[model samples]
Target: MTTEPTAADAVGPEQEAVETALVETVVASFDHCPDPRLKEIMVSLTRHLHAFIRNVRLTEQEWAAGIDFLTEAGHITDDVRQEFILLSDTLGASMQTVNVNNVAYADATEATVFGPFFVEDSPRVELGGDVSFGAPGEPCWVEGQVTDTAGKPLAGARIEVWEADEDGLYDVQRDAGRRAARGHLFSDENGEYRFWGLTPTPYPIPDDGPVGKMLAAVGRSPLRTSHLHFMVSHPGARTLVTHIFPEGDPIMWKDSVFGVKESLIKRFEHQPAGTPTPDGRQLKTAWRRVRFDIVLAPAGA
Candidate 1:
């Protein structure tokens, strides 16, 4: 004869107890954290993370693989390369962060991903000077102005610019001592600025790493559309991080990084050889030109 089950045995605690223990234990770990913000973030993250694990019934093998992938991404990151940022960009997390930080203003320049390529202290170029630094590409003239939301010029505002060469590589990807096709300049008294740069071209994000393999596994391409990156800032205004895409770039609408904004797309006009530049420098070959005026919102808005 067998004994009948008791109420405690019939109402098993395995499933519910385990999940409650996991979430409570993790959340409690942050209760003594000195920083209130950190403590709150930790508790919320723990809750969501535990919920996600329970929802997916995540297997140990899958968890191990994810850990390995993130480890590999960290292993490949270095001074000039940032695999983590690449991962964030391809996953749309970076864009989401940008959206949160950049609230809309009255016709202010839209913000986009601040990718992994920016180099501080880039060469300072004079107005109308060439930033191509001998990188191979068709000559292009970039003219723009920095203005407030009210359309008043912001003279002396800094305009930082960088872009990949025609060969789809940045200076940081090349020789250590060589800097090319990236620079910063101050606006003129009238808030006007101009510089010569290489025509933008589509390029693949560093795809020899884990993030690239993950993208490939998901049938995603790593190509970013042809565009020029700009960071415009004035003392009391919100700095704008944005890009201007060449109008006809095939991948603009489907940028792998989800960085394209309709307002940021500008038509690049092709000028045949023998055309004169804005500063009266005559071109030797066919070139392209695009004008992009920036409107900055008040800082801390």
Candidate 2:
């Protein structure tokens, strides 16, 4: 004799039909999208998003709260701030994208988030010149070279660098007409590049808005470890955006946005007081020195 059907096997056809129709309806709406890639993305997004909502058994109140949270994040964003990026970052979505895009390349400096503070049209500085603009922090000597995957120097490569001041504030975060802690320069004939910058210090990830509240609610802090940001580019090379964290930072392994990578950490050496500087800046105090070498992949790579 056959056993009676159990409750687990009692799924109704209507239930399955409703769930499948929900996804198919959303996906079909994107069928007329002009761009094939966009259509494909929308279809996948619709399916995954529906699946997520169903799997979590999301309530109407919870969905409304999520929308409100995102709306607040958008309202707080401005020219010098990016709350949406912070949301993506804290969720590990930024790092996930980086991992997918940055395939392993031997000896090449690893990439990190291009944090919200980068400003376009940064003042150009010559090699060995100071970009600090008298910003208050321990002076730092940053030197590096840009090379190809094969270890060949790429002279004249543009190198853009920026960092937060000792107080963890960027130029834009301060008063107007300030361009400190950020500059752009080019590699020399031997692929060498150098500039005077401030030693990076640990800073918070703009925790005065919605993103901060989200982090707090989830028991996560908004502090990022001390680090310097760099963008290197050459005519035939892929533009590289990354950061170098100073070794021994208290939060080095606990960056709020998950931007740190083991290969990107560098030991910053402290020079003795009154040591002669390379660029002849006439500083009368001790300073920090960081050496970073970059390798760029071919544009098509």
Clashing pairs in 1: none
lDDT of 1 by residue, 1-301 (tens): 9987643343347876977887898788887899999898888888888777766677899999999999999999998999999999999999999999999989899999999999896999999999999998988999988899999999999999999999999999997567898999999999999999989999999999999999899999999999899999899999999999999799987898999999999999999999877888877899989999999999986
Model 1, C-alpha of 295: deviation from truth (Å):
0.3
Whole-model lDDT, model 1? 0.91
Q: Which candidate has the highest TM-score of all?
A: 1
Clashes of 1: 0
Judged by whole-model lDDT over C-alpha atoms, candidate 2 comes out at 0.88
Question: What's the TM-score of every candidate structure?
Answer: 0.93, 0.93
Q: For residue 258, give model 1's deviation from the true position in Å.
A: 1.0
Highest lDDT against the true fold, candidate: 1
Candidate 2: worst-modelled 10 consecutive residues by lDDT:
3-12
